[model samples]
Target: MAPLSKDPATLATQGKKAMDESKYDEALTLYTAAIDIRPNSPLFYLQRSICHQRLQKGQEAVDDAEIALYLAEKLGKRDLKAQAQLRRGIGYFFLHRLGDALQCLKWSKKLDEKEKSLNLWFPKVEVGLSKLEEGDERANATVPELPDVSDKIAAEKPSTPAPVSNASPAASTAVKQATGVTTPVDKIREEMIQNNTHVTWTLYVKGVPKDKASVIMEPRSFHISFPLANGSEYSIDKDPLFAEIDVDNSRSSVLSTKIELHMKKKVEGKKWLAMEAKEEDVKAEQASAPVNKPAAAPSYPTSSRTGPKNWDTIVTDVNDDEEEGDPVNSLFKTIFKNADDDTKRAMMKSYVESQGTALSTNWEEVGKKKMEVTPPEGMEAKPYEM
Candidate 1:
């Protein structure tokens, strides 16, 4: 496809066409471009708000809707404000904010009684509120699914070349051989590690000021950019991570010499075939993934008759006579099965890095310090000889 026209008006029109065709990602980019050029235009934000809603980005949808509402209010355009309120209410609904959603929808109705979308949203909010009152915490109505982008992904390939065939990672090293992903500059090197329950990517850079760096880790992608010593900026915005990650748990740490990103995998033990999921990969993922909408995970109820439940120990039954194929291995397996995600991560990291000389499950302590090989009292650690 040809590039979008530079004019803001043309971009907005193109965005509208794309939005109508359900090409939300394209529409979002176009609308963002238009908004950049025409900062004062409420219409652009309103259109972008719809795109965000269809993408199921509730916060972004709410933000854009508020921007449109604010601009409309200033101009006293009751009709635009009504539409904005309707979108705002839907955005709040997607965020599972029942009270806020109801208020916004009511305002939208007061502004324009004939608004068509209100008919669908009003009852959704009511149902959600009723469910909340009835002791159902996860009671929000179904929001729009994220835009299906397999076709778009297939069409737009990365500028940089990657291996046509996916390579298997080394279990011990967690990195694929001869598969280092380099950045725009030859000096920067990046590696992706598929750890036991998460993925960690490290970027080798130097002399980066803490305040000048910006790193964003999202569910499907990540973006990194920072100022270099030579007055130039280094950036790499990778879209579509090899697999989905848990955004809330995924985090980044910046050190003096390197930056590390720890991304909790959405599905445990799912190997990443590549650093980025190309066309074929996305299709396979969609095919194998669940067809139903998102469902909440079941929580273990506590017998805490008072304040918060204690995490120091959970009373779980384990049969003492259970078969032990490998006594040591069975013990580790038993401990791992009952451990949480963080504890599992800590155990893996410490055991692997310490050369099996130490094992620790305290995530807080393990995270802040580097692990070292502490051999048995009589044994000494040494480099492996070929």
Candidate 2:
């Protein structure tokens, strides 16, 4: 097929059409072309930014959205300006720029009271802001006073005529001053963790006592099946593990106690997975093993409940650009990189076979149930661009 022309309006229209059809990559290319032709058009940049976001290019998306906001403001287009602000704010939220995000979102709300679209699209922004306030910085902030909804009848009560009493004017002034006073730690945290924000947790791995080491956190919990590198038949069938995390609020942050992992023993006889020997015994085995030193074993992560350090690491890990060649990624890449080796090939094999066996035995009965739930239009799976 011939390449599309780079005319601004033509590219813009094609980009919109591609976006509508969920051809996000094509839409991005078209939008970029449109911007190339008319670099000052905020609409083109903003549209391209949406595509960048869908592709999970967080930094690029934020940059494009920011440019859109600046251009929209320069153009004096209020609606477009509000949109740009909201987009940039959402991008910031994903980038963990809580303070900047809240400022932008608040301004966007002020520009347009109808925030339903923003709320729907960016529910996490609110969650993130709320969580941030709940943490160390804004934890002590006083909540805004809500009107007493207790008594409608009292509101309608007639005011009694009072005689002017010869009271000290200074005493009245003192009472008024006292009523208006703010508390020592009552200032709200400027940075907010939005309501729908995804909270990241870290699992610290360390040796017994003080010689602590590596920490890792995955989005969700799963059984760790570490395939040993050497021919050593060592295996951990079932072991208790934990993930430590920090709970943050608008004002302050606190560490959550460890999240425990309870695994059932893979072997029928053993209740707990065992090492062939105690920690001391392992030293002997290490000495006898081949002289080629195996890579250092990953230390169990510390419990985040210990302090804010875990939270800091979590934020740092998540926010750091993967392309920057961080040591943390390299460390993780080394460990469990051979998870799908021959030794662990049966990891899901038995499970699948067992399920298949049951399905085959009950196929007829299940088929009857399936007939009732079948869609009116037959379902077909197809790969589509987005």
Candidate 3:
């Protein structure tokens, strides 16, 4: 038959299948051909590195992993880079560079502590280092014997799900089909926190295996299922998300502490006020949301001993005097300009509220009580009786 199809996606899928069957050598050959056809794919390089790691070729593994990490960094793919660093650390372990291997593995954990593979190697590396520190010269620290199906134990992730979009990076995680109706049972505890561009649901399920869990990502909903430690299955199903999400960018991870499910917000900068939407979600959200408006200019600074003064009214009074050419008004304006902040405040409060019957400079007494019109001895102050 003619050589395997030239399509990189087909070759990648084939390589994954071979690795699943423990045919790592054949997987390596297929991935190499895939890399030749599309040399820029960090995903392909990373997969090839996995092949070398399984075949126990230390240098070749590191070589491919280095290329994968370099390309991953260029692509700004933290997830892919974490996997690359993890495999590179394994390569260093096979080469007997325990110190370098430990460093790479720790860095990989820092990149993504939830990568899962770090859990397996951390204890093994620590034990080996402890023996070396104790001066055990003959203690060659190698991983446990590789078994036919033990790849499940060491693999960074489960076999690639054959999602329809073979060329997309999301093909790495095919949306799993729900086995049955999945609902959160009383046995599990779940918490969700919404962020601006992303939302995360945290599940605290004890003794959850990485391979035992499954996730289904969709634009408006998601479902996740896993077998619990107590010989029962647990699941969380949200059919209607509070808002739409980018299904392609959504992902999940499991850790010893909790299981984290992340979904990217479909509308950038849109806040999901709640985890589930309702008929009145929009109205309630708008009512509770803070109004973000441009700030108003601050009032003119004043050392008024009483309280805030109507500086706008004072300015308008000055303008009126200029237009009318009132001698009394001009004289009062001169007095106002010469007064201190407190004196000016008392003049405005007493003059305005007293209806021009008084203009006081005593700020200390004016602030003690509200100003009231005190008509001359012969006059009586009356509201709306002017």
Candidate 4:
């Protein structure tokens, strides 16, 4: 019989299947074949890395995860990139690299909140930090006591539930008094602030069109805000954005804390340069007397529109690719430039798929015990020394 034929996508899918079956070595072989066929496709590397993690090869898992993240970002797959960051964070966590793990998780969290699945894992980080802090405190012969709030709330409330009033005079007056001042629109900022308590700090993106800009949050419940329209506001939950973190007691150690805003002014600057070059080209064409061609219709790439309208949701189907124009390419551009209502849905979907795949794959096997390299040790000499 002829040798079996295998393609990259096939290999990748096979690897994924094997991983699901917990046949990690078989999965690694398939993933390796997939990567050999298509080295730049981050999915293959990410899957292989997952297998490495499962085998307890923390450093190798980190290495592949880093490659996956860099490639994903370069390919404009923000979601996959964020997933890679998360994988890296997990690897770091296993290796006892708390600061690095915190940074990766924080950044990945900033890219998308749904990616905040890592939030539950953060309690582990906190536990590790607590242990370390306790050890340090023990070494120093001092430790702070935990705070309590239960008794204060008990003292404030009498031992009875307040009676519900159906239109009593005092209740009506109270409702009337409150109704005049607090519309839902007026309460948006207040509500956001109240719900955002884990937000130890924020960075405001400045000097961009309010409607055309976006904020990327990191590591769960953290936010980076910017002014939107009117007195109204918009914030990017760190939940979904990729970030790097270095958490310390001082606020100064925060990641991207100074707020490096990549303003639209930068785009305008590029436009200015392009116009200058275009003017020179126009002059050269004029001198060549082919100016009769009416300048070839200005040659700008037409922007394509084929995506959903929501910011927090993304919808995808294979059928979506059949429409005219390159949706993926356009969507990719929109993410780097600015995440608009038109592009936000596709962006979210892209991230969801990319990250979803990365997380579900067998990454932990890379660091698992079965795959570990044990060094050769000398056997007992059968009492010859005696």
**Local accuracy of candidate 1 as per-residue lDDT tens digits, 1-386:** 57755556567768878988978899999887766554545567788989998787988887787777765665566776788888888888778787777778888899989665564466446644654656554454333212232343243332334446454445423332112222336788888888768988888875555544556566787766554444444556566678778977988876766888898998897788777888687666655644342233222222122333233332122223355543225545666565666665666556554657666676787655545655532234553311
Q: Please report the candidate that would top lDDT against the real structure.
A: 1
- Provide TM-scores for the models: 0.36, 0.35, 0.37, 0.35
For model 1, the stretches where C-alpha displacement exceeds 4 angstroms are 134-386
RMSD of 4: 29.1
lDDT of 4 by residue, 192-243 (tens): 1111112223343223232222222222113333233343333333321111
lDDT comparing candidate 1 with the true structure: 0.64
Model 1: ten consecutive residues of lowest lDDT: 296-305
Q: What is the lDDT of residue 288 in candidate 3?
A: 58
Query: lDDT values of the candidates?
Result: 0.64, 0.42, 0.63, 0.45
Estimate the TM-score for candidate 4.
Answer: 0.35
- Count clashing pairs, candidate 4: 46
Tell me the TM-score of model 3.
0.37
lDDT of 2 by residue, 68-138 (tens): 66656655666666777777766665666766666667777877765445543343444344445445442
Q: After superposition, how far is residue 386 of candidate 1 from its true place, in Å?
A: 79
Per-candidate total of colliding backbone pairs: 0, 46, 0, 46
Off by over 4 Å in 2: 121-123, 132-386
- Clash pairs detected, candidate 1: none
